[model samples]
Target chain A: MNVIVEAGANYVGVIGAGEGATGEQMVQARRVGELLARKGVRVVTGGLGGVMRAACEGAVGAGGVTLGLLPGSDRADGNQFLTVSVPTGLGEMRNALVVRSSEAIIAVGGSWGTLSEIALAVRTGVPVIALGGWPLPGVEVLVAQSPEEAVEAAVRTLAR
Target chain B: MNVIVEAGANYVGVIGAGEGATGEQMVQARRVGELLARKGVRVVTGGLGGVMRAACEGAVGAGGVTLGLLPGSDRADGNQFLTVSVPTGLGEMRNALVVRSSEAIIAVGGSWGTLSEIALAVRTGVPVIALGGWPLPGVEVLVAQSPEEAVEAAVRTLAR
Candidate 1:
């Protein structure tokens, strides 16, 4: 068990819709954040509204650190739950960084932006566990039934 | 015509693929850059390769100022044609800024990244001229057969 314990910093990105998240999506995303936080995993996100904020809040609630990669130039654009705010004024182009930076990803229902992240992640060989997220062709992403399952898959993927 | 060319900074975004652009794509993008430069329009781009580099080179060839919004943190990642390179470190999300900052957009052949920019620009009501680029759904973007026509459309849109 001691041998399996990783030594370096591990970042888990929780990706989903920035705005207009459904009630169920927000709940599941927040729960995923909480579960990952409880296991001492650092949660990463785009840090705006909807699912990003929910995940960050969940991480914060569980005493876990959250990193917010904001699209705007202003740091204030980040959510209140972020422990660190990287205001990357790159707008939507920052999605590549978000997908690339994460060791593993937990994706809930998302938009075209989220679809793009999934594509980028798959292309770069980043493991993604989708919880009702966009379905892409020619990409092999694991589908989770619930938040608990998503977090479980994430942990298993990263532990290896 | 001289009166119409008022003294102001006209920022035009030249967006397209990083690589895999056809020779025709490069030629048209270059001509667009040249035309914009002749009309005193400041060209903006992602500043790496393909259509962006070609556009910037044309702008420089015609003595026009070009700005590159780089995705990486390294200033050296940007191409040489840019008069000013803004290292955004935001990766692909910089597309939004590239679109929003420009008064009008000229899109050459592109992949997923360029497709995202076109979608974003249309969402924000920024005029776009697609010079043999992808055809997006529900977006009213102008399709031009040549670089001259693309530049003409952009100039007309911005002037209005």
Candidate 2:
């Protein structure tokens, strides 16, 4: 019998909405997660609702492993799609942790909290791929018109 | 002339999608920004696309200052709503920077990327608020069913 060694999966950070799901943002976030799953990449996000949930659902649906980085201390805070939920006691400061844990960041539609996460991501030198918003200051701007293009750009960037 | 001290706003880090707006995710993200703006909080995020853009828009719309953290070296990566743009060439590593810069984290939903962020957040002991995802270990769990509730939880947690 030959023993095979399994390598650790590459992690990607996702940030976005957590309200009632219903609109273009939700669709795009889900599609992006699916595309990333199709590419055989593990997905990471702030397990909540809206875009985060959509992405988790998409990734899990695609037979991919989805990790949920929680904000609270309980597992109930996480969505059902998450394979593993890591609880971070950090409250508002968790933004830094999110940025630090990922090799790259794929930003979707977001708000104030999301903006702060993006800032930290840029400061840490993570490659951020944007789909329909403004580009980062000194990083490569992978602006995609569609979810497919956004994920494609992220994959291509990761490949490099 | 009486000099009134203007309270320095908390440097909030934002994270989210980057596609065109209109969805549950987008709405949630926007609400986060709105809440922050109403409180005169400084918002930060990846200055592009879906959630980031929406958050920035919401913050600016509410008379709040928004910052964009770009992943590339170009200003084009930043969203128009950002009052300031910080350019970072770190690529995906920028995610780490974002997490490091913040005092806490507010997770909207769950995604692979978000999960990674949450991991970093928890690992760093940054207080995190989960609106629709998993909670971090040993941290306060604030499962906000609405945007107002989430923001309140985040603010209250950070205050401690």
Give the winner by lDDT.
Answer: 1
Give lDDT tens digits, candidate 1, residues B13-45: 998877888988888888889999998899999
Cα lDDT tens digits for candidate 1, A1-160: 6532446757899999887899999999899999998988989999898999999999999988888989899998898999899998877767767877799999989566676576567646789889996454433789999999999999998854
Identify the CAPRI category of the predicted complex in candidate 1: incorrect
Q: The CA-based lDDT of model 2 is what?
A: 0.69
Candidate 2 residue A157 Cα shift, in angstroms, is 2.0
**CA displacement after TM-score superposition, residue A118 of candidate 1 (Å):** 5.5
lDDT of 2 at A22: 48
For model 2, the superposed segments whose C-alpha errors exceed 4 Å read A1-8, A20-22, A134-140, B1-160
Off by over 4 Å in 1: A1-7, A57-64, A69-101, A112-160, B1-6, B60-64, B69-101, B115-129, B133-149
Backbone clashes in model 1, listed as residue pairs:
A90-B93, A90-B94, A91-B93, A92-B93, A93-B92, A93-B93, A93-B94, A94-B93
lDDT of 2 by residue, B25-122 (tens): 67887888888888877777767777778778888888888777677889887878988888887554455556676566666664434544555555
Could you give the CAPRI-style class of model 2? incorrect
DockQ agreement of candidate 2 with the native complex:
0.04
User: What DockQ values do the models have?
Assistant: 0.17, 0.04
